[model samples]
Target: MTVDRRGVLLAGTGGAFGLYSWAAGAAAPAPKRLKLRRRHGVRPKNILVVLTDDHRYDAMGFMKAQSFGDTPTLDRLAREGVHFRNAFVTTALCSPSRASIFTGLYAHQHRVVDNNHPIPPGLIYYPEYLRAAGYETALIGKWHMGVETDTPQPGFDRWVSFKGQGDYLPGPNGLNVDGAKVPQRGYITDELTDYALDWIGKRSGKRPWMLHLAHKAVHSEFIPAERHKGRYTNQTFRYPDSMRPKVPGRPMWVENQRNSWHGVGYPYHGTLDVGDYYKRYMETLLAVDEGLARIMDLLARRGELDDTLILYMGDNGFMFGEHGLIDKRAAYEESMRVPMLMRCPSLFGPGEVSQVVANIDVAPTMLAAAGLVAPDGLAGADMLPLARGEEAPWRTELIYEYYWERNFPQTPTVHALREDRYKYVHFHGIWDVDELYDLATDPNENNNLLARPGHEELAERMSAKLFRLLEETGGMQIPLSADAGERNELRDPKGPAQAPFPPRFFRPPGT
Candidate 1:
């Protein structure tokens, strides 16, 4: 409630505009300590957050999105816990989404808009707050943010991570263990799980601990563990209806991207069949699932299964050929939506939650689980109460943003507003047309109703809401950083070409 009104809140946004006490000066520092509170009848529990990269929302066995997709560990977690059915990320890239999860701020607010951007100086991670509250924390896996350094970050007693996207198999760059270089012994997923279990086993003290086990599986160059390599080879791949070459009202940019590196037609700029790639991706995810099973088994053996808060989520969703696109960074469902499952029988019952949740909600939820209130200026709300079936005000609309990256120039800067039944996407720094989807009826997003008659008012209203949300959250200004990552301009010679000039740009003399 102590807000320094830096600017007047925009009218009708149902939000405020101000800075927290921590945002007072240049190089504003993250609060080194958090105030802890005691809750009635709810004891602080061990928290284990299992995060996977590029794992989409519906890829679990329960959803059956892919006939071959089966995640027994993930499915059991959902069955035993609360499944946030409509969880999404504000930004669909890895680093930005991870940063949002850690800071409880939007990518624009945290200023890690793209994968290459480093964690802004002085931005506090959520774990730091937990650490301050007397919780032992360890981050054991990929820390791709803060620019490529595997060095130990603050706020954790135990630190085990790799430089950017550590390989599935041990490559040149090995593991970084508490600021020391340790050779990656075996498969990355299994090894990370080993580190996590080892840490948990050694915790014979009274203080509750929190561990963030981030996995490198199911990412690009999808490599499955030796045992899971050919697990789904016999299953048939079901292509999404929207993956067809043409869809009415589809943006030209999406069409032109079909032959580029992240497209269905020529994925990876070669003859990589998306079907096979998807199979491999599913195979790669099996190891992560097994790792989760191991974690749960350990907790159960220690009589802490029901006492621990176990959460499994994907950093961001992936696209296996939706809208002629093969990767994320788009406002499409498969790209922005991610799986979020949380379990702690001592705290809440198991059921499906329809309320929309996102990466930003993670921090406040964790802090709430620890019986502490999140500091002001965090854009996310605590979902633990909501999950307990408490009647709290929930967001009716969600805002999504993805800044254009120089390395991947195919997808433009995207801004979108997602409501229960409708989604409106706006493109920036490009000449492409905007998009609107009626998700309830057109789940595939095969149609863009933005240009349709009688839908103009709806589009305008959603667009207004989108911009107002962005403005209210201090996302009106685009964050630009020095260009990093290798740029790829290659296109398939025989792939589909770009479309002609749009009519909005120029009109024939009489037409």
Candidate 2:
């Protein structure tokens, strides 16, 4: 049976003439008695997933910033929920990370490797699974998965998204509702929050609901709402110490990337000033804090505070001068790690979990919260047990893969294996160098131990493990080799090799 975009199943209703009926001669079987299992605690009847674009893990006050502005609402959420301290994304790009969260699959499995790549048409999002189990679903704010001309997949009953990254101010490039472009009148962040609250107040279902309140704030072209315009204008912002112009013993790849796309020195139009960029960035973050406050207030007023599972995360982490980089898509810690806070009063006690988890686990966790079975074929496990503080055998190491052929080519085909104490980054391209870090001793990843005599055996073991992980995850396309010619041909240096499509966008300088 087919279902319409509105989620109505297009099958015939039961009628006397319908086939496959019970035999008339069979005596009406006594109503089969089924025993219902007693639920442990109050299961959340609603879920609110608030996601921001390009938000860093350490940007909030709860993460113990030295001088950053206070994010009271987020702070409270962190205090009241189970904060995953080691949360990282499978792919550190916006679209790919979001797709991983939705599909519980890695970038290679989903085939959405970059911003311009379309999400595979047949993949089912967790919201579709939730809707199948009797829940209302709605998607608000940015949906950067693909071009807006394509119809939204059959998950949400309501959709409000744009084609790609949209501007903060209202104009022709405003948000798209369902499929029609709607001119926005106010700042995009505030408008998105307003729609989210309105939808919650007007929903007509007694069954549980899942609201995806995705925001476009804290993204590039960082512009704050008018109310937050001058909040951080006069504040003397403190830059990360790592942003210094020079650091001794830094690798050539990192030193040369000082003014690249991930670099703070890169020219971002004429509007940005190197001396004052952090001030504007802080101001832009205030709007997101305000948005969080608004969402919390709405939930409190509706008496859904204790019954809703609120999950807050960034689509991906961003870099601010770490190793002289400013954007994401790198295998480094700053770019790969994202903040994940889950507030479900019914399930988890108020505490922080330092266990490592990936963005791929988000879908199965959401499915479990809705009391539905996660579909088979997803790579992630149902993380509800972990969220509930039930100790289980978890992954000791995390695998990361980034096919770096986007508009920015500053990095290479980076395949990394990150254990608790060590990190191994294999570069499979001509333009970059391989790296290995003893994370326990060098959290900054400043030192490469690959050539060190004492670490040779350790490096060999980690390299073997990395290859094993790649083989398990179907990441064998990019081989582990240092030959520039072989690597370039394997990666198709001319353009995207897998598909015969033209380059999605031009490769900027220093990319």
Candidate 3:
């Protein structure tokens, strides 16, 4: 089936590329007129994008993935604007995902597949287009693209950022404030918000502004603010069912990882409990929630709350004891899907958008809101029409890729095809069995159906489609850069036993 620009379903050729062309084709064109025009006249809209690290999709009060997750501010954004319930990232890592958001290209396309890689030269960030269109741009908080420096990059008028995965508290070397090193005054979350609000309030001209307030909270070694510390210490956690030991049909490598660094039995060197770690992560997220409230309040007080386009999203989703894993860089739902909410009453009203949107779509959406078109060859479409409840042709499947890192070798390279109701994950350079899950029936991915009696053709078709996406999008070659960060492949001496090889690997007596 092929969908046209008007979203009309039509009969099409039946081939590998015929049925799935629209999903992996070039981005759809923008509407003839955007929603940036106001009642008074045509004017560009202000944009504010707030990003958090390792936030899960259902970790909000409304979604209730956690029993004690409180996010009144984020809930308000979903209540007042468009909630992208099915948002995901192509690569579930900090630098690669952030690079995708800025450049509107896949990690392989932009050549920033790993955290230590730098943004390839001559690549223009979409914010530069917004700046060229007479809008001021500012970047505050974490910019983990090029792990070497915190100095300002192009496309932003004002810059306030820190080094890679900056310290939760003030460190020996403080923040880099527009080419100067300054002492971090308070908690990283609140201090980043202070810089963001200061920049937003100090603009003196009539030009619309774009601010990217990225927070470093909620990352590993989680540390909550003074007021929010131990907030969820007493709350109970609802662990995932897939975390059970010796789950039937579970991949052997996933079971073996239970004793590795990212596994549940020995998470963070066996010194961390999954429940306590999860509580701390949620607690650390509280300050980010409060910061959102403050930004919204300031915009409301200035009478621009409804007019300004505000977006709240996460760089990548974190896992909590899912499939015996604790971090991202895997193809599981909890590791790739993130919370994405956008509010601009001038563009759209309160509702939910069910389409599968990715981090690569953010750049085009922001450019569309500012009445500017994104550059050619972007891998994402303008999602404003979908947010406005308009019928538009969209992708039916998303390709997720994660390159193997020398720092964390427990998880292998992953390339998966995620459809609405099914997923097929392929592992590279490993001897483990691949995974296939019927998400509609088994959302937890407890039962892998790769060896099922009647699902062989389904898995074969999906696997073929997965590789075609990579071959078509120039992702066939893996990009390698200088390896950095500490190697964390160490396993606890007395942890759980390594998973044995699958029984299928052994031959029958007759054979």
Q: Runs in model 2 with CA error above 4 Å?
A: 1-44, 147-150, 245-249, 267-275, 478-511
Q: Give candidate 1's root-mean-square deviation (CA, Å).
A: 4.4
RMSD of each: 4.4, 11.3, 7.6
Name the candidate, 2 or 3, with the larger lDDT value: 3
Cα error of candidate 2 at position 382, Å: 2.7
* Poorest 10 consecutive residues by lDDT, candidate 2: 481-490
| lDDT of model 1, residue 219 | 87
Put down candidate 3 lDDT per residue, 431-493, tens digits, no spaces: 877889999999888888974456888999999998898888767766454567899988888
Off by over 4 Å in 1: 1-33, 36-41, 501-507
What alpha-carbon RMSD in Å does predicted model 3 have with respect to the real structure? 7.6
Superposed by TM-score, candidate 2 places the C-alpha of residue 318 at a distance from the truth, in angstroms, of 1.2
* Candidate 1, residue 310: how far the Cα is off, in Å: 0.7
Per-candidate Cα lDDT values, in order, are: 0.83, 0.70, 0.84
Candidate with the greatest TM-score versus the true structure: 1
Error of 1 at 185 (Å): 0.6
Clashing pairs in 2: 262-325, 262-326, 262-327, 263-326, 409-511, 410-511
The full ranking of all candidates by TM-score, starting with the best, is 1, 3, 2
